[model samples]
Target: MTQINITRVLKGKYTIMIVLIIGIILYNIMNDENLTFTENIIGRMIYTYSLFRNVVSLTNYEEIEKFRSNDCSIYKNLIFGFSNKNELGIIVEHSIGYGENQEWSILDEYESLEIENIMGNRHWIEIDESGELTDGISMDMNRELHKDEVVVNFIVSKKLLENNNKLKQNLIRPVKCSTKKLCSNLYFDESKVKVVYENDNISTINKDDKAESPGIVIYVHGGGFVFGDMNTYEKVLQKHAIQLGKLNKPSIIVYIGYRKSPKWKYPIPLEDVIASISWIHSNAERLGLNPNKLVVLGDSAGGSLATSSIASCLSIKDQSKRRNNNVLSKRFHNYCKWVDHVKFLGLIYPALCQKCVTNSKLKNYKFGFLTLSSLLWFEKQYQSKYIESYFDWRSQPLLAPANILRKFPKTSIVLMKSDILYDEGRLMYETLLKLKVNAKLRIFSGFHGIYGSSWSSGGSNALEFINSEISEIMNQNN
Candidate 1:
């Protein structure tokens, strides 16, 4: 053979050997069903390298989707990253057999008017001349309706609500401080009060009695619809209350404990939030709360709830205007009385749309501490068989009708650039602006739950942004 031909053959053999080696490495990485620690580490490194290349090349949408759908676990872990061990620990802790092997129950009854009252103006009943409950709807009617529609719409089976009367329980149960003591504590300093409305205990924090009535902030805590309560968020709430008090703004901070999902289904949590708003409106005078200057603030899942609650209020208002019946109109009007009072909405890295979970754009994106798989898992646990039910604005606020979006209050959206929901938050802000709703967007470089760690170096900016928004709202009213 000629010398040149021999060289060509050698080069071809070398190229084939390299390709085979690469193929074997990829096959091992992809085919390992139950990877050892060492194998997992190697797999992660390879996945990360591939992800980096794809991102740098600006991979097309189809290719990204194919990659994500092909290997969900590896894709998720790679995007979630291993740098934040603390975050990884949280994910593992929360994901251990998350939704499986749990007790389930079917809600017994359905009551449209009862549900409506809970969703609308259930707080409006008053003591008549005979000192008896005097609302137009009868208990019998509520019972009959409960057997029908409420069961269909609001019922779900889950471990959290099965044994415990969690629906009526106070969210601050874990605080170790009674209402009176909490009010007197150093953090609260006579600025906190606990009140029960509709069998649900809510915490109200404000300034000293002599201070002027201030704007109201109805705060909803986030736990992915399964874990958070007032006690979990008390310190942050206290800090905001204290800061506002010192400024002489004296805002009434209402922490609502709504029933969570996988325990209570779709409309239940939303209705509970609405009930709290109704309670605030009914007692606005006594609480020294300025109803016209109300701000609804929520983080993560709570942001979704906050947005939906406002949408519900707006819906109730529209319905009330179209109805002529004095009784129904009165109930809806009472429910909607607080709608106009909502002057601002603060969403901190909110899960605005579940559909965003499967969006192709986020397939290669690093979702900070939250992984796409975990988000999907939570969504399944929260909605369960009612996945189709999320099409409405009640579950996904971004899916709200244009008419409703137009009526949304001035919104201040805080998005952590690293969060999976960041794009959705920006989309929501832009959509609000397109609908002519007053809106502002602030993006920070942080993780999903950074807002809760306000004292941490990474979260301080988010905390300050929130404080400034509150200050701006107070100034507007002043």
Candidate 2:
């Protein structure tokens, strides 16, 4: 070979070596620096990456169809949806398994929601029993809708929501506080919210311009605060649609997307969540949904957020109780001042208390899908550094004052036996009862991530319980 040929071969070898080294680093080490690098560098190429994942998921759609209801097919018309991927600063395990034994057990240990997400338009990444990821999805084009469902993709102008609330807070500030300084520091974000309902002879379908819905269920999703988006939880929304249809309560189900943490911390996620509620209440009359009847449902970490949101709502609703507690001063933006409208709260295996380490956590946290290691990591990433204390009720709704807990809307706490978060769910239920806040608690067999899945007998039963609880809440005072 000539000298030029030798130089080119050397260059090729160098390139291969660099690629191999990077891959090794990524495979073994997934710290903040590694993930941030991925988010900033590789994530920008999501348009192409998403295209490949979308193709893979399209193939899985055929197999996952039986598990999905017709109305749940969010990717029936797949559009490149990588832009919709919420970049989490750190990735925590929401249970690929608890430990090595749990991992080696069987494929049955995985939730069907794992396989059910095969049709997720932007989020189809499923870690199989082999611990290999073989799927993904992205969004580069406009979100599409299935023929049978009235799926309306809407944007909550979080920036606008924050500014409007700033004005309100400035208006309501106590005389002691300085008028020159704003009462609440501002957090600006843009959130994607989807409104899904059955297509039952609706005349207009202009995204958010109009909709035909009787009542509404506002859903918040969980991914250990590191992952999860509207796409990942489409099946849960579909489950809601199925139950609502069965109960003859046909309502608009709104799924909201908040920014992931470590990249975006604490109050920002909470802010995005409450803003969705305010948006719904403001537009209920226009959307043809009953403003007086609304329910908020959340899973895992989302349950904590949902609880915090309602706690914020209660703080705003009953200010007399806010006198002594300094945390109560951390009011959420005028989140749907129609607090009376939120009829109920549904929490599925929620992480309610940041400080509690119950018997269940001691036993199941090490061997469950939601492992104790992941929970500690999640709290570290998800909690706000700016806050005065880590255990504040902002994230730990279980710690909210007794008076506020007393005023909480009717709530249903659903749990799974042998799950890490079970005891806390029970704790919340018992506390609610102590406070005389109309609360119901149910425990089913199996582990976390089962309530929204259809794989195991336990998952099916848990899902049924959730459906029934939500249905009862929707029907109450109707």
Candidate 3:
């Protein structure tokens, strides 16, 4: 080879070596045990910028426009990554703004006005009738009003959801249950069923199909408050329901489809939970549900919501006693009565406290890649003032006052030893116990998503513990 070609090759090899060394150094710094919060934030920023740069480099503007198209299902697939193995047929119903008919807009007048000015001199100035803000920007008007309005009645088969390794790897994926004889899609409303006996005659009815008053379990799934949907957790919930049924304790599991953050922030998810519980309470008699036997179960971010919702209910009840009446607070005070029916709460590897992230026990606890930067990113999307008011108990239930903690119902918390939030869960459980609240803590050995992943044996154990507690509560109520 010529000397000139050899020199060029040598320079290229040295350049590659330098890049690799820099990458290794950055990785080590990011994972450093003694890294401060500021350092962590900087590391996360660099990591995010690198990822964005790579993505932009790979896709051209034309391809980006195509991906942005409203008709393109790429965004849906990207967000909801579950697979439909077989032709699993299911029906979904969509409604707008609770019971009222309301035309929803994606961008408000402010955003629309801004975008209109951007396309002032452009030749392609078209505003679609179906809430398309721009050519490629669109929004689901129905979802904008409220997510609970969108309901699904479908049966998930065990065979259809039989452990797909590929699907499990993806954090976000669609899960569909097969429409075979094993399961049937069923819908139940207040009109379909009615309470067989009055509240005074609770024990008089037989434990048969007609007389049995099934307990209701409202499940809230977890996905860091941003990702996840009913489709992702349908199988897991169905399995829990079937298992509960086998114990001769029939129960209806209602999977809550709460709105995610960035679009709907803070108290919005909690509001949805309150609304769902209110609807369930109003229709408890017709749904053959024991109004006194409601249980709220949540995992991860859902756990935070569950704790916050319970706390909010207690706060409303206490505030109602005072004479200082505001219209909004009064409405909340009335709504809080419905949540009073909740008898038990179950949390699985829950994110109870944000402050605990930097606690002595958890400062270096690295499991998932959700570092301080990711938390800040989510906060930006959520449009929260948490950065300024970091110790808000609504976001961190562990920081709640003793009175609120004392009012918690019979609680069961399941924590994984390998989880970053393990210490936070332990702290919460301890606080609950200290307040003389009926609480149980179960610790297993695995990472954060183990319950949702292949290591779900721990989840079964957690379920058993929860069921046993529920049974005890039921007997006491009886």
TM-score of each: 0.57, 0.56, 0.60
Model 1 pairs whose backbones collide: 105-157, 109-146, 110-145, 110-146, 110-147, 110-150, 110-151, 111-145, 111-146
Candidate whose lDDT is highest: 1
RMSD of 3: 13.7
TM-score for candidate 2, please give it: 0.56
Clashing pairs counted in every model: 9, 7, 5
RMSD in angstroms between candidate 1 and the native structure over all alpha carbons = 17.9
Error of 2 at 440 (Å): 1.1
| TM-score of model 1 vs. true structure | 0.57
Q: Could you give candidate 3's per-residue lDDT for residues 411-440 as a string of tens digits?
A: 999986546677788888989999999898
lDDT values for all models: 0.52, 0.51, 0.50
Candidate 1 residues 1-478, lDDT tens each?
6456643542343433443355356645554333333333333443434433332232232343343343333323232222221101000000000111111111111213243222321122234798664434344533332221110011111111122232212221222211232122111222122222121222234312343455677788776765554435544554555455434354545676665544445655666576556555544554334667788899888999899878877766665565644333444544456777787899998888876543533653332335575566557545533336223456788887888789998899997654667778888999999999989998765556556343234355676777778877877843
lDDT of 3 at 247: 44
All candidates: CA RMSD (Å): 17.9, 18.7, 13.7
Where does candidate 2 stray beyond 4 Å? 1-213, 320-333, 365-368, 387-391
lDDT of 3: 0.50
Per-residue error for 379 in candidate 3, Å, reads 3.8
